[model samples]
Target: MIQAPGKLADATVPHIITELPGPKARAQIEFDKQWTSPSVPRAYPVVPVRGEGCTIEDIDGNLLLDFNAGIAVTSTGHCHPDVVRRIQDQAAQLIHYSADFYLPIYAETCAELARIAPMTEKCRVFLSNSGTEAVEGAIKLARFATKRPYLVAFLGAFHGRTYGSVSLTASKAKYHAGFGPMLPGIFHAPFGHVADLKWFDEVLFDRLVPADEVAAIIVEPIQGEGGYIVPEDGFMQGLRKICDKNGILLIADEVQAGAGRTGKMWSIQNWDVEPDILVTAKGIASGMPLSAFVARDSLMTKWGPGAHGTTYGGNPLACAASLETIKLLEGGLMDNARVRGEELMAGLRAVQAKFPSVIKDVRGIGLMIGVEFDSHERAAAVEWGCFQRGVLVLEAGHTVIRVSPPLVITEDEVVIGLKLFGEAVAEAATKV
Candidate 1:
């Protein structure tokens, strides 16, 4: 295995034993069924026993090349030595339970975030335990800051599964089925349709909600779960103008698209406009339970003491891991993502060209990618086929194949993944 710079991971090779979800994992699943809710879907059967660099070994002794990156959470790769060392060091020193109390690690981590934030002129950050919690905090901060109840989001956006974030999510009904009555006054507009930018500017806003009553316009720079849809050139600028005119906060939900998962530090950096509020999670801590909602200090002041606080939010262990993760990403991981992403995207496009009937579209930025097919059945077939072969991928929306590999993945691994993906596509074509 080629060793990457910055020494984020250990120098070692990956090996496989069993297929996946070996007998050990199957038994664990049975145990999980007794305690866990079935509504939470599982994509793979392999139970990871250990991970190093860009590969994970399951309990069944199967070594699978990771392409999903733990659903885009482990951008730096599984069990990076630096991150793991940080976590272990912090755990031994102090496990947790500070609760917004004075902590050096927390302060340092927040300062690092503020330094790298899009608009740092007067920015502050509130740390949380997950992406959904970050979303919840963003909405609360916006509503409390503006003293308005209405929050405007785009269609086909997946914020999170919490009640507040669920209300903002417009693409899937299953996320909110029987979970409501959801938070009211949330409006959704058709996400910028490049085909009809004029309507998005002239008519869509009026049809959804007059800009006057809206408190915030929450969006993802690149819609992650909404099939990796990238907005047109002028879309973000238009939204920025709308927010400026209406006094609405622009909250970019970067939980899936941020933290170098894309080439840039955050997906919003690709656009000229900046968000008034930013919510991020997933890869921020390199797989630790860390998320944050950052905003201008003036807007963040809306939260009075105890207005929004979580018991385990911003614990020292998570902050320690996050601080190291930030250093690693800033050092060179992002550059690797951009370079490897271009290589992988080029390969995927070639595959798309070769299989016109099976592949409909290949689109995404940096390492966050999606391959769209004509139907979900075809997408599932391709996913199952890839899994059977060895590479692990993910499916999103109705017919989109999502591939978010660790930023540290080598070009050869990507080539192997594409080859496996091509095999899956060919098999899928035969079935069709």
Candidate 2:
């Protein structure tokens, strides 16, 4: 069984050694503001010095329990020994010969992905550096394979920030306010609503864009960034049936919800439908920069070799980290996620019951959970409260506090974190 590092396997976490954003952190924040791009959002002033498992130490030596997992990127937890060892060993041997020159680790990573990808037929993977690149790759492959000109995406779905994927992203107005005209032929429908699907079939296909012209319908099984909104039953199945009938591809954007975050390899697997393309990243390489777009072999084969390619797509170091990450996830982290997620969700529901006015809803699968508040100000206050108490959390959409802890978080740690979260909610209740 996979185990957290001995130092971090215990409960007494969120140990605050100094005030939040203590002297050193404040200095660093000032330096960062001066040098860094203004576009990067800083939810809280957490200047992390180092991390192990579910705990991160700030520059002032305050140990904080990390529930955000670096925005759900560290599935196996921060600095997992096995993953780190693979990275170290691979770095010593070969860091980046580039996939253009055929690395052995690339083939190994692809083989591992094929073994786990949720496809009945043989699968093919195209590795990229980030979630945006993965989505872009999927878009190109779908359009080329289907020979279609249009695409369908859901409202509140965050594909990525790149040109092509950004066009498909409808999560927030800020992400699209100035960046238009977006890529043409991309249609947006309400997320997790069957009526939207029907409207697409009856109204859109009949009038706006013909079904035959559509290339793909991209969706997030559990909407991230927008909110941790799990679709009602039959919604995903309906999309699958619609895609099957119309020859339009179903692209599951699993960037934030996949890689064992939702107690499954891919969140879409929670439904009984199979997507034509699956885009995943964030937690794939245990915090390393790696993303992949997987599809059926037949569908992937339509594009010629040079039609889509990347220089550092499957770097050896990243592939090694990914291979070890898969091993850890398959070994025991996935089950741990399910158990701890249930425990965390139950605890959050109880907390929600105590403050119904503050917490509007609690929803998620596995460790990928969200607690909605009455308003954005309330959510922000609660998040700040958590941070002050040494538990790091993030705001999703406008009013949801996301609780995506590392998969390797221990049972004791979950209880402690939830307790802190509850306390934060109570504190925010009075202020808000």
Q: Return the top candidate by TM-score.
A: 2
lDDT tens readout by residue for model 2, 165-279: 9999998999988889999999998778666678786778988988999999999999999988889878999899899898899999999999998888889889867889999
lDDT at 308 for candidate 2?
92
Q: How many steric clashes does model 1 contain?
A: 3
Q: Kindly list the per-residue Cα lDDT of model 1 for residues 133-227, writing each as its tens digit.
A: 99999999998898877887888999998889999998888888888898899877778564543453576466765666678989998998988
Question: lDDT of all predictions, in order shown?
Answer: 0.84, 0.90
Where in model 2 is the C-alpha error above 4 Å?
Answer: 8-11
Error of 2 at 273 (Å): 1.3
Residue pairs in collision within model 2: none
- CA lDDT, candidate 2, residue 421: 91
Model 1 misplaced regions, further than 4 Å = 1-21, 194-209
Model 1 lDDT, residue 155, Cα: 84
